[model samples]
Target: MLARGQNVPTIEQAADFVERRRPEVATLLISRSVLLGSADNFLKSFPGGTLYAVKANPHPEVLACLGASEIAGFDVASIEEAESVRTVCSSKPLHYSHPVKATASIRDAYKIGIRHYVVDSEVELDKILACVSRPLSIAVRLKTPEKSGTYDFNTKFGLHPAESVPLIKRIIDAKVEWGLTFHVGSQCKHPKAFSAAIHVCHSVIENLGKMPGYLNVGGGFPVAYGQERSDLTAYFVEIKAACSRMPRVPLLCEPGRALVAESGTLVVQVIGRADDRVFLSDGVFGSFGEVNYSKIQMTPYHLTRASAVPSLAESEFRVFGPTCDSFDELDQRLLLPATIKEGDWLIFPMMGAYSNALASRFNGFRLPSVELID
Candidate 1:
């Protein structure tokens, strides 16, 4: 049986379960039960708004759940991703929000009925104009500098606010229908970062002397990794306060990580142990750090044939992966119950986002199989 607490998966039980079920097969089990709760909570929090950021985790089950929960659209960066969203949840609006635009990508997006586009430079704007033939709606991404303790999205895309004005004028002069958008950064830990971006949006609208139909406050909401993060309600309150000072416009947000992380776990078997150091069957390159570049914290517990309970003391242990590469270490030292042993099962939580999406078959380690648990 699965344990009840968030950090209480026993290692011995996990190993025995894996051995009994499929000795040769290892898998990454996704807890849909946890994800549905998170998705429903987020939807209730951001009522009457569209969320279209799909850069986090695009597992088809996750997408189908989000679609059922009434997500308004999907913000996709590539053809493959757009197709993935389409495969799972069709009929929602799609935003081709990748700042850098390629000619072929634009043509494909147009053919796929993606009318909303985000452009950062005049060159990209020209590219969009050259290719798009339908009634298109565009969002001019504003280049905002990265602040300390917040994400910096300016390096990749967006025009300077001053530069944005002329772009708006040019688009208006050309009679191209467009809107305004800006991404504060990724994994933003502060609500002020979003508020500041909204303030900037207000300024842009005031200067342009026209209100676009939409304002995309691009994705940057954070997910809890080792600690509870800032409350998103407070962030939305700040956003509402900021918008109160500006002209009324439809608001949209693209949140990827906050929606999917913490709803999944990475399970690995302890293949070998030597001098208190345990090596896992999977490696970092196999299923960790495609989006968030950090090692997962291993929570080890006793899982197999149990004996009388021992004193609840802790010990520090190092964990390694089966890869031959020296850098494939999972964790150097993690605090866990002192009774861990070889052939144990170790689980790492909050790995639902970028880990699986960016995994590779390096070192001939087969990709961890995925199963959804509702």
Candidate 2:
């Protein structure tokens, strides 16, 4: 029988066990512990509202959990994502939150009953008006200044606050349904960034002299990659403070990585060991670059038998993937238990979010199969 308790085997032991049992599991475990924890945190922190960003990880299981929790909605970029959410959850509101606008995509999203969307410019507003025939609600993405040490969303989308207020005015003037939304960017470590943006939202609302409909704070919740993460409560406090000033407008948050990143793990077997490095069966092109792009750190563990305790002492080792490209290096200097050896298994945590959604099968690498664990 498989290990049935909470005390599971280390990566090295798991690899040895798999060698005897299910050798085909190239990437085996994606634990629910991290996922549930992250999702629960988001729900608890943002009592105002929460919308799981579908771009993070579109796994049906993840979506099911959010739906069960009565999450506000989904932040989707494409019609396929909209359909995925529809398949998993009942008729919940869907936000076509991608800042950019394509006519065909707009038509499809409108067809699928996506009333909420993000518009940063008048041109996108025009495209949406042309494509969407029915009375639809929209969100104007406000381009706020990027705080220090965070990814900037202003470059791609969102209008200047001054311009946004007028744009909201124009939408109202045109008798079009619309709301106000702002994204501070992704992997935001600063809680004040949201507070600052919320203050801006207040100004915009006051300037518009109407509540509009919804005030989307946009998703920038950070996940613990390598370093210690900030408290979600602090960020929520800022949001609450801002929202309290304008209580009538509904609040929405689009959290992608924080919802599913920690919930999943990537398990790979060591296929080759030579020199000071060990090459795994999976590569960065396979399912690890999501965190890498954000420069997030990862923890690797060795799994083995119950009696065979993998040494906890750490040593520097270059862990590479099966890809031939030089950039395929997963970790330049990963410190793992000294007992890690050939044919061992390595497990990476906080991989449930962006990895699978953004993974590319480059160099003919096969995507890892996902296994959900309770």
Candidate 3:
């Protein structure tokens, strides 16, 4: 990985370069080793074709690193996402996994070679039928009992198991290939969530009196943050065990956060400190949106003083963004050294997921400059 202009071959060098420059904007540090390793882990262990969820982090470098691995396709929520993935990894299959889609996106996705689509209702199936003349594959998305996950994904999407049975029949009757899929939720903490969700899908299929061509256990894979640790393999084991009770079919998984979260870091400078609040260059609408949107707890930001002596007196303080808006602040408090001054750098690791994808260019604070490190 390479930093902007200082030939930073290591994270150490990158930190030193940033300290010397004292730039007003924030920096996103990308570790190619970590990114590639995460992709390799999913490709080697997941036991089936894996699709990188494009909405997680679609940066060119991020996509390029994963593209070089064994990932087979991309889980795209929109035609625009498919187009972005196409620009970098053009040959890979595209799965339009968003249960609901615009008819125009359906026709365009077909023209762009996306053969796999997911639907949660009959209206979506009709939309797909109206747009595509060629053979297509549909995956019926069933809403599973969500007991884990940081985000409430089911609030806006997902279909009830009872509702999915009729939808599955509609797809089969339409003469198109079909499958079953579910999302346990994002950043899921419970291992049993996958198994429970799979059970819901199976029961729906049993009601329909048939099994699908494939079973897509949707992406909600978790990542460790701060002191929280999880046995990721246990999730796969539980999912496999649960599937044993259902008719055998080709299995697939889509992992977003677990695949890329630990691969990047956000480097921000403390612009100011007022009482117990510390203001940073990037805030809720910037690279730190995950902290605001999902209440994701970050590992305490690491202080890098470079050649200077570190402070001994540390305390917890509220962290705020550089934006003028009052709502542009982190939901949690951060503990840092009392000596942390305006020019000091605070590094936030595990920031690759949803950071780039959700950042807004509001208030003229564009997304941080991404610097890749080897």
Candidate 4:
């Protein structure tokens, strides 16, 4: 709603724009200050080189903002993300961080000037070797504890310390720069989880008898969501202490959610309501895709009434998305004013990470429009 090239100075102005326009489509308000501040804080707090994980939120504006920040570079999971980043900041460094990459993607990333690649197994390394020859740095993915974070990634990627020694040796045998990397998992709660993964990396380094060029503590930085919150400083302190024992090498990190989750606020309107179920303009198929899991809760919404109405007590409501599928409902219940009805707007904050990035254009529904705010 504000005219093109015009930006709202605050969330209140953004809400006012929504109220005036009353657009039925969901609108995402991105705070430029929050985005830049998050990047600045992470860069200052993190021990070494920082690479924004492009997979978290690759919105053009998001990429543009981080590209302008002090971030050292970006870690892209696929050729598409690499291309997207290149389009924004052609000179910024790019790391092909995904453990498993398609043959063509490896070739494409190499062509895109990406020299660093991560692998969990020798086969993936071979794939990279077959695609690109020299002037490369390979990071072996070390498997960390599965229960360390809300979402476990050990089952999908990463190699055990015992299994990683030989693989790292092969990376060294190739005469290319070798390093160790591990993900504690996404939305990691326990700061010690990072320390545990670092310990595993140190063990692998000792077993190989070779100092890695760098130690990549892949992103799992937590953010406050619902009642789940942890001090970001605690994570940094734990990581710095653990790395103190390891061989001195450049430290690297790929932070996704921790860098961008708090910069976004999603405003959706109520379309329909039943006894206790309320349908929203957007749902799991849209920006709320992550809400299908009970663990992911977007609560404490600010209601913007379409018309003046008396306030009412809050009550739990089953939230549903604007999709034909029966499974397009959120597993978590939201507490809204009992007088909540159709045409009311519910604004949910801290949604800048995977919301629109994970949305699908199912049933001809478009993704939420993005509005940048200062």
Candidate 5:
């Protein structure tokens, strides 16, 4: 997320601002209505309580919209994130979902009324026990082999089933509110992956001879960004059925990308054009960081122009960001107008997830100006 204060620019009134400005940049079009609509959808259909994953898009405007929609909670990865969520909604619960946390983070989170945490190892449990005196609720992060997502987060977090068994036992021994949580992956393509992970959770509980307090089907819910996915209604239906197979327990989910990806769009101007290549004002180091795929990954994009005479001719070209490093280029080609030129804007849709949140100030170019649409 960018700073709390920024100069909001209009895509129509100041469309040529990039050409006139000294340092070129992209523009983010965030729809407050779309964001709230997504949250409302989840609240209506999700089988259990919903928690917005703060890491996906931590923009204050987005959080405020979700808060207004009455989201059940927030899945924060860090203490700082917990504090950020509090700015919008102080009464809702905060789930510190990151498995590995600094000791200081635990202390501060405890001070801030965070009672739920995710841990995969014994050491982290020990740290939580030492820092927090109040009774705590914990969800064991279970690593899953079902790989159906665009991004694989299992390599970094979560624990294998065999590994989770001992940890679950330890949690039971400690006598705190305990549960099982698993992330099939980010932008998971199929709902079956979630069902499979839940079966694993059920098996673990069966073997342990104890039912957990809840089961968190962590955020891997898919959003339309160019790839085919089960309809949101049907996806939730499938997930709800899967959870039914598990032992009777309260269900919770932390959705980041699926909740916010469609809520925003990226409007990037063509800095200049070479033969079959276009240089954008922003690059991977900026708002396009999570677009680690070639060919913009199926999310829709369109050109904003004064004249429609050039027609909507499609041409694939290599795209580059504003950064100086050669490695800052996008993973694949982008299909835009062959007549695309400087001052012409290209708007990338479904860009809310992992876009601005992962941006950096490398080469003196930070995230682009964002306009929140009411």
Candidate 6:
């Protein structure tokens, strides 16, 4: 049987919950202990202050959990996100990390006591300058090499390191505290990717002839998904070794997926099956946005039959969402037991990061309700 109010319920308990409740709609089970464990991993792995990227999983419970952890603050893209974080934990520092911003957002963020902002161009810097007269802590994002991440963040936002020299100088001249920052990209599996970006920042600092207030490596810290377990220690070791040559300065990181991805699970029921195609209660439009839109690999999943019987036989099957659109099918096929049928449950792990945060109510399918199992 499932144990409610427990901090670390076993997988058997979760399977039992799915078999007993038989929820018609999808269910999201969250574990506070797992969230804390991820937070602790991040706090111990990085050699600098950490900021949770609010865009990854901005659930109120997630925000509150990290707010209470050793995390320094949050990295928000819009004023709404800043306001949301403020509501949960008012005192945590907020950084406007998005490169482009509306003048109104800048003004509202400033009003809400957000002093840190990221800019990649003079136009954005001008916008920030026009919005506030007070000294601001600014991070100039440098366009660096895209070494090895699932998503490339360099194309849309960052300035060439050479071009950032003048911008940083201008920020310093504006009597604002300045810093250098870059994103290695999302799900960065390579440890040297960070070292490479830091090298570029080092060059930029060298050109400036003086160290800035801080060097934010930005968030690309990876977490294990599917069959691979990433070594967080390797990434940390590489970053520490690379930064050894740089001038002594404060360091910061904005970890979104790594801090919250392992804390949640998505439970969906098999609604229908045709030949080798199986339809689920939730799809790309709902909790599987990353799988379709971002092309991120599916999280690890297991099966739980409603009858509580186990199957050892296995076969490959195509998965689809309940949406009317034919494109709702998952990009990759899943291997499941040949006995898998309608009413059986599919429990996906490591879904705490971007699953529900990006869900949409398409086809009149509501987002999954979150249940704290721990």
Estimate the overall C-alpha local distance difference test score of candidate 6. 0.84
Q: Give per-residue CA lDDT, model 3, range 1-374, as digits (tens).
A: 11122112334644665666765778777888878877887677676789899899988888878877888888999888888888888878999999889988988999999999998777888899999975889998877796588776788777888877778787888888999888888888888998898888778877878878999998888876654433489887888799888888898888988888877777888888888988989889888877766777765444544543345678888888899998998888877887677767776667788887788888988778887767
lDDT of 5 by residue, 226-254 (tens): 54432577668788787777668888999
Number of the predicted model whose lDDT against the real structure is largest: 6
Query: Residue 49 deviation, candidate 5, in Å?
Result: 0.6
CA RMSD (A), model 1: 3.5
* TM-score to true structure, per model: 0.88, 0.89, 0.92, 0.93, 0.89, 0.94
Predicted structure with the largest TM-score when compared to the true one: 6
Q: Rate the local accuracy (lDDT) of all candidates.
A: 0.70, 0.73, 0.79, 0.83, 0.77, 0.84
RMSD of model 2, in Å?
3.9
Q: Tell me the spans in candidate 5 whose CA falls farther than 4 Å from its real position.
A: 1-24, 227-230, 293-305, 308-310
Residue 12 in model 6: lDDT: 52
- Between candidates 3 and 4, the one scoring higher on TM-score is 4
TM-score-superior candidate, 2 or 4: 4
For 1-374, candidate 2 gives per-residue lDDT tens digits of 11221123333334444555543335635555556666776787685678889988887877877777757778898889989988989667888988786889998888788888788888888898778865778788887766533678777777778888777887887677778888888888788888788778788877777877778888888765644543578788877876777647777888887777656667777777776787888767777675456776666656553323457676888878788988888545787766666666666655677777767787877788876655
Tens-place lDDT digits, model 1, residues 112-186: 889888887789889989999858888889865555234466766777788899888877776777788887777
Q: Rank the candidates by lDDT, best first.
A: 6, 4, 3, 5, 2, 1
Candidate 4 TM-score, true structure as reference? 0.93
Q: In model 5, which residue pairs have backbone atoms overlapping below 3 Å?
A: 225-299, 226-298, 294-332
Q: Which scores higher on lDDT, 1 or 4? A: 4
Worst 10 residues of 5 by lDDT: 1-10
